[model samples]
Target: MTDTTTTAPAHGVTISEAAADKVHRLLVQEGRDDLRLRVAVQPGGCSGLIYQLYFDERVLDGDAVVEFPAADGATVEVVVDRMSVPYLDDSKIDFEDSIEKQGFTIDNPNAQGSCACGDSFS
Candidate 1:
């Protein structure tokens, strides 16, 4: 029974409840309590930018953080670097576990267009 939600700055991206739950389970499976989910926009892919998501232990300077409380009583921290803030503003991270596709997805209102491969956006 920890705080239900801890959000980042107003302009920052958000994590959906399902995404938080999935992240919590993954973190538990990894057995590492020190890691945070890092989300970043990188320069690659068919479109102008690509999204990167991974577990990181380092809290680099200028990183924005948001915390979500999971059903398993774990607090999952999601981080985004300073450079990515603008591109990801008001975006959302979600998890899908369907038979056709299963993984984390981003819904970015800022994206003007996305690649057909679904790996990058401008």
Candidate 2:
């Protein structure tokens, strides 16, 4: 018999297993399979940049996509617009479910500093 090996996808950004699982659950609740987690950076925040995360049903031009496997054998897709690629490259997305914080966080190596509110980065 032949053996098969699986490798993680090489994406500009990566989502943690926890994040993927959460996304999968959200999608399941939404009852849609055409949705993708879209991440974008826009100019307008305490640090002059803000992050936008949402579920998208449409695909625009120059979009980069990466698929992650969920614990339930479902697949979660993440899409990054071309304009935000440079700022988000090599970044990691994780979900936190603790008393202190309960939300999605982005660990961006390119961010030099953030504002006092911790909502934006430079």
* Candidate 2 residue-wise lDDT at 66: 75
What are the per-residue Cα lDDT tens digits for candidate 1 across 3-24? Answer: 2155544337778889989998
lDDT at 11 for candidate 1?
A: 32
Model 2: clashing residue pairs?
none
Supply the TM-score for candidate 1.
0.90
Quote each prediction's TM-score: 0.90, 0.90
Instruction: Give Cα-based local distance difference scores for all models.
Output: 0.84, 0.84
- Over 15-80, each residue of candidate 2 has an lDDT whose tens digit, in order, gives 999999999999889898889899999998989899899999877777777788887788788888
Model 2 off-target regions past 4 Å? Answer: 1-11
